[model samples]
Target: MSGSDTVFNVKPGGALHGAVRVAGDKSISHRSIMLGSLAEGVTEVNGFLEGDDCLATMNAFRAMGVSIDHHGEGWVRIEGAGLKGLQKPAGPLDLGNSGTSMRLLAGICAGQDFDVTLTGDASLSKRPMRRVTEPLEAMGARIETAAGGTPPLKIAGGHLLKGMDYVLPMASAQVKSCVLLAGMYAEGETCTTEPAPTRDHTERMLNGFGYSVQRQGARACLQGGGKLTAARIDVPADISSAAFFMVGASIAPNSDITLENVGINPTRDGVITILREMGANIEVLNPREVCGEPVADIRVRAARLQGIAIPEAQVPLAIDEFPAIFVAAACAEGTTVLTGAEELRVKESDRIQVMADGLQALGISAEPTPDGIRIQGGQPGAGTVQSHGDHRISMSFAMAALRARGEIIIEDCANVNTSFPGFVELAASCGLNISQN
Candidate 1:
């Protein structure tokens, strides 16, 4: 579907069944392209997500003189340019809707010998960039942003950066990874202490590439002047993408589903933890290791869900899955309250407000707060919900259709390709009557 022409029509009363494996982890996919581009040898990646977001990351690296061969069927070969080997791109790096690409690449561009400008789509351009620019500037990398600290970032590279100890005001893996990537070019050691843990894909991928990233509790440290050797990476299924089905199966009656080869890294397993705490029946089976990260198969069965006060400590862990979790909350038995997640306001869309509006339109009682939202569980009637160009919001509403009273129309769903390319097909295969038009 054309970007402007994409929409989703979902009918009520469907259940997911059987087993499925979601696309490659979006977080790991972006890092694979990035770390692979900077390594010394050829990096072979299996199960790469062919989504627009990760593709944006790949294309950006390609513009920077990285040779990437896309073999059909999720196989990619990236010819690594050793650290400090990236050439200046001829024009601005357009990162599309991927905040991950824009922020993470800012760090990689910080130590280069050339000046670069990074821009994104309308939605991404509106998101904050100062979170990254501030830390990069403190390390002596000259940086500029649009008014209100938005994107269209102008980064002046080749400056000597000095390492510093930084404490993150919020638990954000993107910001943490940004500084860590810049730390690679700084003099001496750089350390970051987060208020809470975030995803560790960057750190693990660094170790897989033969670079040492030391972690102790909430703090992680990395040294400058290191080399990365290209290594084989088998990207696992993304838990965030699987979260829709996880919630779908949990809320829909007589539904049972298994998600295979999902990355269950401790830092990224917050959704599973939160769901279990809310009385979801999810099982972790056949645990193993893949490319330095933990992997397992998850089986979820339908159960009566109860709303509980979500612990703030789990906010950062399950941040990306909250949209889908909110759908589960609407189908739950009580009130679900979440807090300490004001970061949602600055995502691709204002997730808290957008979700609350959508839920209210569906006839559910969802109250949006400055930091979080409170939802009262009840049957959702048919309604049209706008995605606001956020992929998670689009998919989350689609999951809600399973329990909706009538057909639900989801607008601006084109962005679903940003993370999960075959979302409609996958959902339909598992018994969801969802179609893209």
Candidate 2:
């Protein structure tokens, strides 16, 4: 399967059973490459995600004079160039379908001493980049963007930047991390106040690299000119990747599955919280810490779910897992209302609209609002759902097939490789009758 030609034929009538470990955390995989490239020594990373998005991040760093050795099977060694060591790339850095690479690299590139243009594939090219560029420019880094602040970002480097206090209008980890990465080269202390809590991977990883990132209330601050020493990172299984199976086991009858070594950082565990509140049976076992993030074994069993009003406080925490959570909502007994998630509109696709459309296509009632969605749970019928080049949307609809009355075909599923590579095989190992064609 290649590109848009890829499609998934998923049939109903299987209950997900047996244990499975999903791919390593995509967020952490990206950050490891970024931070490791800037550290002072060799940074060894185990369990790195071999997905296209993370590979794009690695390639971007390689373009900037960083040496990364991939030893097959998720182990990687990156020779750091230290701060102020990345060389000018010979051409525009192509980040493929990764918005994380483009956005975060924008911050890192702003602090460099040479000009670089960051470009991406069709889907990523359409995503707005001004969220990071605006703040980078505010800190005195020169940046030019496409019309309407889209990609093909042109950044003129070698500018001396001065850090300033900035309050985020929206809670975005990418935007926050972008400014923080640029802040490392700025002149003073850089602080970011969030309207709501976003993922703190950057802060956690910064601390692991021997830099100090202070957190007080909703604000996180770091000083510039701090050197990052190399460190070892064991990337835990992604909770977002674990979410599909969590919902699968939760909604399908006679299903029970355990996901091992899943990262359950308090900031990123909203999916578990929301599902448990909806009356799903989920247990966190063997809770421990791995590489500065919380890890746990999650056991989920099928339950009769009853939808409740999802708390607004959890919106930022579970933003990425909503598509799969929406599938769980469709299988629940009542209505699930979600709000304060307008950020979904700016994702790889407009997630709120795209998921709503896919759910409606599958005979579920989902109404899209400007900032949220209202879903009425019922049986899902046979239908073809478009992924809209969004990986989560494709996998979410596949999970929908578990409870569906008939077969469901998911289109444009090739993008699944961007995050969860080998998804079809893993889903099948867990009892899903899904295959790519």
Candidate 3:
């Protein structure tokens, strides 16, 4: 299986059971690489996600003179390049399918003394970059994107950025982090006010590295002159990755599963909140703090779900997990209405439209709204759905087979390695009758 040539064949009917730990947090993993590479000393990271996306981040830093040693099984050591130490790559830094790498690296590269270009695979090339570039531009960083603000970002270095108060046009952590990361090299204090709270991993991790990021209400501010000292990071299991199993165990009959060491970061736990609001049987166990982020064991069991309008406030919190959330809606007892999520339109795929089309193909009534979607709970029938090279969409539809009336075959599933690398094997271990070819 390679590229978009992979397909997933899932049989109807199964119950997910047992305790499993998913991959390390993708956002945290990405930030660890970025911050570690920029810090003053060797940063030892435990529980690093070895997914293609995060690895792409690692490779990008390595191309800039940072030395990173992979010690296998979720452990890595990074030799810092300091705030102004990244060298110009011989060519464009290929980030593969990682938007995080392209966006965040654009910020980091903006203050360097050498020019660099950031490129990606076909799918990532089509994703927008202006959200970060426009703001970085406002801060005096020179960046150029292709038409429609897409990827292949060429960021001109040696620009002296000056800190300014930035108001985010949307609730995007990547954009906020972009501005904040670029702020590190700016002339004064940099602050960003978001319309809604996003994952604060970058802010938290920055502070962990001896840099101070202040948060008051919806605003986060930091001074540009501070230097980052290296720190150890133990990434909790990604709640987004745990979400598939959570929804799987919630919807399937007699299914009960416990996910260990999952990060329940307040800003990123909307999926759990939404599912619970829809009558999911979920329990938060052994809640504690891990390196300034909250961690917990989540237990989810089968329940009869009744859908309601998803809270608009939680949209930013669970933005990435909506693909799986939509699957839960299809199996619920009523209609699930989602709005205030126009962000879905610009993800790896137009999630709202893609999920709606796939659900409709599977005999469910899913209407794609401009900002969100309307899903009518009903039984899913047999279908061949297209993932469109989107990993989350492929995995979401695979879980749909649990309540499907017949077998479900998902196309273009090879991108699952971008996030959850061993998805098929891990899914099978928990009783998901899935195979890939």
RMSD of each: 0.9, 0.9, 0.9
Deviation in angstroms for 304 in model 2? 0.5
Q: Which stretches of candidate 1 lie over 4 Å from their true place?
A: 1-3
Output the lDDT of residue 269, model 2.
97
Clashes per model (N, Cα, C within 3 A): 0, 0, 0
lDDT: worst 10-residue window of model 2? 1-10
Ranked candidates (lDDT, high to low): 2, 3, 1
- Checking candidate 2 for backbone clashes, the offending pairs are none
Flag clash pairs in model 1.
none
Q: After superposition, how far is residue 120 of candidate 3 from its true place, in Å?
A: 0.7
* TM-score for candidate 1, residues paired by index: 0.99
Candidate 2 per-residue lDDT, tens place, 1-437, comes to: 35688999999979998878999999999999999999999999999999999999999999999999997688999999999889999999999999999999999999988999999988898998889999999999999999989999999978999998989988999999999989999999999999988999999999999989999988999999999999999999999999999999999999999999999999999999999999999999999998899999999999999988899999999999999999999999999999888989988799999999999999999999999999999989999998888999999999999999999999998889999999999999989999998
